[model samples]
Target: MDNIAGTKSSLVWAVNIAVVVLVLLWTIPTFGLLVSSFRDRDQIATTGWWSSLFPHEASLRFRIGDAETQRQEGEVFVIDGSVFEAGGTVSAFGTSNRDPAAHEPGEVVDFGDGISGTVNEDGSYRVTSPVAFEGRSPRLFVTSVTPPRFTLENYDRVLFAQGLGRAFLNTMTVTIPATVIPILVAAFAAYALAWMEFPGRSLLIASVVGLLVVPLQLALIPLLQLHNAIGIGKDYLGIWLAHSAFGLPLAIYLLRNYMVGLPREIIESARVDGATDFQIFLKIILPLSFPALASFAIFQFLWTWNDLLIATVFLGNTQDQLVMTGVLRELLGSRGGDWEILAASAFVSISVPLVVFFAMQKYLVRGLLAGSVK
Candidate 1:
């Protein structure tokens, strides 16, 4: 008994540690993406997401007001301004990009030819020359420890400038009907296969099961040709039909298996009460199949929502029809270096699926377990 107890305790600790490791593995990258989305471009480029949560030392180079804005002060040409708009402490400053932060703030540095500049700790700067300043405004570089900063500008740019907002709506336009139409058709087919006897029923079930192993990519070209031949070329309707057709096999298999597990006595009792097959399905099977329906709905919804290949092949990549995945792919090609935009766009694209999963997860688990056990 003592040895058994010790073994159980060791097993429990091992399981708990494994769970912690798994959770961290899944969560860390997602957390980083979420944090990066709210950051500005410079911050994202300069530091990792974890470092953005704390005050950190950073360096920046900028130019003072142009020479055109200079004033004659006491026989000297002068340009004066604050380097930071919202006011920040400056630790060091420099006039040349090659040696940024070369001089401590408050130290006046003389540039040969009678040009001198001073940057105060408060980020205010003044440049003076006995002769008129020429060429352009002198550059200033500062290194300072800055407070944590974040912005929604990335989201703003992705949604409006990069066209992700329109893509989001386009994805919805494809996903909603694609998810709903197939469930309705699959539910009726599943009911017939499960309860209402018909010829070649077993063969049909076997065919659906076989289709589960068939690769969708294999049929892409053939299906595209078929759609085009039937005058449904490269449109929302065409994509919807493609998604529904691709989704149906699994949807029917799940629903039929779940329906087969329902208490046959209930279906039989309803049938004897002068209730037709459709009536029995509507009044009895539909309500009891809620878990299964929710499960397949969530599955089809997610699959359609995140689909890229089908959308790309069936729908044209126009601004009006491009989905979020296509927009993300475009961003990857065009804005590959823009991590903030990519992170924000990815978060926006995934938000709906996360909500749907969390909302229907309980039903999905219940349906899977019920179907598996019976």
Candidate 2:
């Protein structure tokens, strides 16, 4: 008894420690992505994502006077309002956004020309020179402490910038139908395979399994030809058909296997009570196969949602028909350095998957194989 208790206690302690370590490993990066997604583009590249969660010091540089306002003030050339009453200790300033810490506040930093500036920590800075910069932009850097700052800039930029809004809508149009049609068609086929035996049943099952090995690329050109002949043209309808075709083989295989495992007696009992195949299927088979249906839904939905290659071909690359994946790909080429935008967009794309998993998780089973063992 003592030995058993000791072993169990030791195992529990180890498990707890392992869990704690794993959680930390997953947590820090995820937190970084989450924080990074909300920061401004410049802030994201300069500071670590973790910095967004807490306040950090930032500097702001503002000028007080223009060239025309330059006047002789006692012993020096002074511009009207050039002296900022609101001043504090300067820490650091940089000429470029790439490095905001090249110079410390209160230090006069040279810009290779006559331009020089002194920054203070109180969000106030002064730039002085022999000549005044009037009627033009004077570039200066300020370094101040900024607290944790988050901006919805990335999400806004992703949704409104470029043609992402239209692409997002297009993705929804394709994904919803692509996901629904296959499940509906595959559900019926799976039922027929599992419960309703017909001529060449084995051959049909083998054919579906065989198709699982076929690469989608091999059929792309042929499928396009078929679509054009059928007058579907290159549009959402065509993409839907393409996705449905690619998704069906796996869908039928999975759903049929699950449906075949349902209790035979329950199906038989319904049949004996004068219930037709359709009625029994509608009332008894479907209700019992909820787990299987949900599982397939999750699979098909996610697959169609993330699809890009087929979308590019069937739906056309035009803004009106492009999907989220296509839009995101374009953004990668055009705005590769915008990590915050990328992270935010990535999280946005995964939101539906997360919802799908959580909603249908109960259907994901460990024991559909229970009867198999017997």
Top candidate (TM-score): 1
All models, RMSD in angstroms: 4.0, 6.2
Q: What clash pairs does model 1 have?
A: none
Q: How good is model 1 by TM-score? A: 0.82
**Tens digits of per-residue lDDT for model 1 on 1-374?**
55554567777799899999999999999999999999888878978889988877778788888889899998999999888875568888887888887898899998768889899998888989999988876778899767778888888998998889999999999999999999889999999999987899999999998997799889899988998999999999999888999989988989999899899899898888889998998988989988889888888899999999999999999999999999989989998999998999999999999998888889777756754565
- CA error at residue 18 for candidate 2, angstroms: 3.3
lDDT of 2 by residue, 1-374 (tens): 65554567777799899999999998887677877888877778888776667667656555455667666545444433322343333466776656767877667676545766665555455555665455754656556556666788778877787566677688789988888888878888889998886899999999998998898889889889999999998988888888888988878888788789899999898888999988987898778877777766677787888877898788788778878888778778987987977887876776777787777666544223321333
Name the top lDDT candidate.
1
Q: Which ten residues in a row have the lowest lDDT in candidate 1?
A: 365-374
Instruction: Report the lDDT of model 1 for residue 26.
Output: 94
TM-score for each model: 0.82, 0.75
Model 1: how far residue 30 lies from native, Å: 2.2
